[model samples]
Target: MQIPWEERYAFMTKTHIETYELVEECLKINYFGMKYLTEALLPLLESSDSGRVVNISSNAGRLRFLNNEGLVKELDDINNLTLEKLDDLVKSYLKSFKEGALEENGWKLPGGFGTYKASKIFVNAYTRIAAKMYPNLYINCVQPGHTQTEGSSCTGSQTVEEAAKSPVMLALDDSGQTGFFYDHTEITAYY
Candidate 1:
């Protein structure tokens, strides 16, 4: 009946192989998955005058966690940040991860947190760039706030209902404020 603590932590932590697999899967499911889906639906979205994209983002995506001034600028440059460019940024981040140069290259989130944060950051940047591409459509990123959900590792303080409101509100908003970030319920600059 004596179980080692390492046994408990084993699944919580990961191997180098797991990290690489996770990073790639994270990009695929979080960033590229969204990208391809949106592209596939662009025609339908374009046809409707009320098209809206409310991406469920997180506080982890906030620029304050990034800490790299140069990277922040690149991520925030809505005018010049294209879809192709975003892919390049993701590629560079992955390269830095593999080379053990994350801190040297400016990524500071540390492994899984770094990947999730980077994914959301990519989603936020994509929201900005896409909103610019389709001015008529309402596209924005909404931070659902840390809520008591399975995804939050059960560390959240808010209810699932409370967390759902942010994206739902953004989905229904017609204030003409596209390419913006919402901290739960308030409109704010992401950077």
Candidate 2:
């Protein structure tokens, strides 16, 4: 999955209005790109006996990063969530973002990168929904720790190789565990 950190950095210090387009671009690359790619590959994936789709997510994507309790509850209710509702929730986030009311609406993050955080949150939610919808597929998302990469300005604590272990583990495992989040190699709560 593409992280779109160049766009993220450009808008880091700007107001939501000033960065609206960049934020939208990030969402298109980070969230929509993953969603569409998975959809397009579903047929082929279903043909395999052990189809797997491992989404690369982030620690910032945790539901606790979102101050909006209602939104958190909505996303966590995977059994009740639908694709349309999840899309609508993302639309609501963008609307609030455009209006410069993210903080007022409880969607703001502490050190900015709110768009990235929201995008990954949507990704995690989408992974859960897809896993439920397609029981035959082993779909999951993983937070490959903070690795040194261009997106992070090379300030992350872990090396690229170190950060890759968790995702690689998920991709190769045949545990039949779906619709869950992993922090490195361990299963964790979405919040």
Candidate 3:
């Protein structure tokens, strides 16, 4: 049950600042939508013997994508992370974006796409949190490689089917691994 949405504002960069509404919309679709959906279905998933959650994350979600050392450390501290803290971090990012101070505030990425990157970063973090909270379930996030989707302007080398393999593999995995980030089917460092 994969629900997809086109990121029409994927072209937004540091120089081409997007509106607050647009930035928020990106977060809503990329992060909040997934979060709410998973939470809503958690009970059903929990009842299953092999419940699994394979979040379709991106390489852009890597902690290295962030220029802010503090933020990176905060996100990496999964043991102490809370949903409230994550929400606050996102609100701070939104404030920085609204103030036109993303770069100064260390919320901007090198190649831009700050909003999208931040949203994915949050998704990765939320994946970890959920996994920790639900030890009975297998929860992980995977970077499906650069696929030629509308978001990538069809410049990516891989087709949509090629990109689907990693996530689908993770979804069907019965190893009981949780709170991991995968680069294609292999486990990778989140930081």
Clashes of each: 0, 0, 0
Q: Model 2, stretches more than 4 Å misplaced?
A: 1-18
Candidate 3 displacement at residue 19 in angstroms: 2.0
Model 1 spans > 4 angstroms off: 1-18, 110-112
Candidate 2 lDDT trough over 10 residues, lowest sum: 9-18
Can you give the TM-score per candidate against the true fold? Answer: 0.87, 0.89, 0.90
Candidate 3 structure quality by residue, lDDT tens digits, 1-191: 32232342343342355689999999888888998999999999999999999998889999998978898999999999998999898888999988999888889887767788889899999999999999999999999987788777665668999999999999899888999999999999997
Number of the top-ranking candidate, with TM-score as the measure: 3
Candidate 2 collision pairs? none
Question: For residues 1-191, what per-residue lDDT tens digits would candidate 1 score against the true structure?
Answer: 63344553354345323377788898889889988888888899889989888887787787767879999998987788998999999998888888888889998674346788888998989989999999989989988887776764445667999889988888788888899889999987787
Residues 64-107, model 2: lDDT tens digits = 98887888899999889999998888887788889988888777
What is the RMSD of candidate 3? 5.5
lDDT of each: 0.82, 0.87, 0.87
